[model samples]
Target: MPKLIEMMKPWQWMLYIFFWALFVTSIDRHDLATWPQFFVKFLSRIVQYTLSIIPSLYLIDYLRPIFKRDNPINVSMKILLLFAITSAVSATLVMLVMINTGWLVYERKAFVLNVLFNIVITVGFTLVFMLYFIRRYRELIALKQSFEHKLTAQNDLIKARIAPHFFFNTVNSLVSLIESNPPKAADLLQHVSALFRATFDGAREISFEEEVELCEHYLAIESSRLGDKLVVNWNLPDDDVMYDMVITALTLQSVLEKMLLNVVEMTTETIFIDITIEWHQHRVTITVTVQLPSKTLMIVHDLRRHVNFYIQAERLRAYFDQSADIQSDVTNEQIVTVINYPLYDVSI
Candidate 1:
C-alpha cells in the first residue's frame, strides 16, 4: 500500500480499490442466487471501498514511517491501528446500509453479532489486499526504475557519440560548402540544429510526425556526409494517419543510426536503407531493411547492442503493453528489422 502510493495515478488507485473490493465482495457472499441480492451488496461494497479506502490511503501514507519499523511492538501497534481505522469505517458504512436496506430491523443480539463478524471479515480482507498491493507496487517500481535507467544510459551514450561520429564530419562539410554552396550549407546548419534538439530531448513519447521530422533531419545530415554512397527509401502510409500515432522519441531513428553505423564497408554500388510502414488490424508494423555490406566488414558486432533488441521491445511494451514487439531477421544480404505496436483507436 505504501509503495502503491508512490507510483499510482489517482484514477489507477481508484481502479485498484474498485476491483479489489468487487473481488472480495464477490467471494465473501454465500447466497449468490439472485441479481437483486448480488447488486445491493455490490453497490454497497463499491461505495464502502470508494469511501473507506480513500481516507485510509491518506492515513496509511502519513503513518508509513511507523509502519516500516522492524520492532515487533511497533509492528503490532501499526497493524492494530490500521485495522481499527479500516474496521471502524467499514462498520459505520455497513450500519448505514443496514438501516436503509431494513437489515437493522432483525433481532437485536443477532444483528450485533452479524455486524461484528462482518467487520472482522471485511477488515481481514483489507489487510490481505494491502499485502498484495504492496508486493505488486514494489515490482512496478523496480521495472520503472530499470526502464528509466536504461533511457538515461542510452541518452548519455548518444551524447558521447555525437561529437566523434557526426559533428566533426558535419563541421568539415559546412566549411567546404560555406564558400562553394552557401544555401546547401545553410540547409545543413538547419538539419544540424534539429539533430541536436532531438538528441538532447528527454526520454518521452512524441507524435510520429515529430519522430519522422527528426529522422528526416538525421537522414539529410547523414546524406550530406555520406554523399551518393547512402540511399534511403521510405514507403509509408498517409500523412494524416502517420501524424496521429505516437512512439518513443528517437527510437526508430536509433535503429536507423545503428543500421548505418554497423556498415563498415559497402559491398554493393550504394548502401540502401529501406523503411516501410504499414497498418493492419489495430497495430502498425514498421520494417527496416538495410542492404548488407561486405561479409568481412559486416562480420563486426551489431551497433544496436547499445539499445539492444530487448530494450527496444520493452520500450514498445511501455507504450502498447504486451501487444508490442521488436524483432529482426538476418539473411545473407540484408538485416530486416520489424517493429509492431498497437495503435489506440483515438490515436488514429
Candidate 2:
C-alpha cells in the first residue's frame, strides 16, 4: 500500500458512511424524526455496507498481484476466472439485498434504475481508483528508471576514466621507444598525441561517417605500434543516412578496444575487423566482426571489471524502454557483435 492510500483511510470510511446516508435518504424521501431516521438508515444499510467489503477485497487482491508477479495472467487462468465469477456473484447478491431490504423498492422500472445507479457508482469508484493507482505505478516506474540512469552514468564515467588510463599506459610503454628509436618514436608520439586529443574531446555520438574517421585515427595510432598486423574492412551504406541518434561518447572506441584486447597480435600475422552500418526501415544497425581468440571469448566478463555491465544494461533498458542485447553469432565462420538502435526522422 502507498502512503497516499494510508492517508485516505479516514476519508474512505467517511465516504462509506456518506454513501450509506445517501442510500437511506433516497428510500425515505422525507426528513427523519431525529434518532429514528438516523438509526433506521444505519441499520437498513448493513447489507449495502457489507456489500462494499467483498468487492474492495476482490479489487485489492486482483491488483496487488500485478506488482509481485512477472508471468502472464493467463498462466493463472483458473484463479483469475474464479475471481471474476465470484465478483459477479457477490454483485448480484448485493443487488438482491438492496432490493429485498426496502432500500429501494423493485418496480420493474425502479429495479432498472437502481441497476443503472449501481453501475454509475461502480464506474465512478473505478475511475477514482484508476487515477490514484496509475499515478503511483508511473511514479514507481520513473524511480526505477532514474535509479538505472544514475547507474549507467556512473558506469560510463568509469569507462571514460579507464580510457584515459589505458592511453597513458600505452604512452608510457612508448617512452622506451622515444629514448631508443629517436625519429621513429617522435613521429609515433606525435600521431598518438594527436589521436588521443581527438578522442578525448570528441562528442558522445557522431555520424557513421564521422565515426569511421575517428576509427581511422584510432587505427593509425594502433598501427604505429603493431604495424602490418591490423586490417579494417568497412562495408557502409551510401544512402543519405544520418547518424542523428544519440549515443554515448567513445562507444565504438570501447567496443573496438575490447575487441583489440582479446585478439592476439603479431608483426607477421594480421587480424581483420569488419565494421558495417546500414539502416532498415526505422532501425539502424552497426555490426562489427572480429575473430575471437581460441582459448576463451567473453567480453562481458572483462567489461564487468571496471564499469558495472549489468547496471549499464539496465540503464539502457530504462532509457529506450527496450533491451540492448549482445550475442555471439557464429555465422559463415565469423563472430559478430550487432548494435541496433532505432532511427528517427531528424525533422522531428
* Per-residue lDDT of model 1, residues 182-272, tens digit only: 9999999999998788778766788888888899998898788677778889998898778677888777887887776666223435788
Best by TM-score: 1
Query: lDDT at 175 for candidate 1?
Result: 96
Taking the tens digit of each residue's C-alpha lDDT, what string does model 2 give over 1-348?
A: 333334357668558646754664565545455776556655544545445544554554656556355553542443344334443444456657766876545577755554455445544554565576658868887887676567556555645754775677568647867788778677667766655665555333446566566567667667766666678898877645544554444455556665565553421456778988777766667788875444444454443342223433343444443645433454333457776656565645
In candidate 2, list every pair of residues with a backbone clash.
none
Q: What TM-score, computed on C-alpha atoms, does each candidate reach?
A: 0.60, 0.47
Per-candidate Cα RMSD to the true structure, in Å, reads 9.1, 14.3
lDDT of 1 at 10: 88
Query: Which residue segments of model 1 deviate by more than 4 Å?
Result: 1-120, 263-268, 279-282, 292-325, 341-348
Name the lDDT value of residue 93 in candidate 2.
67
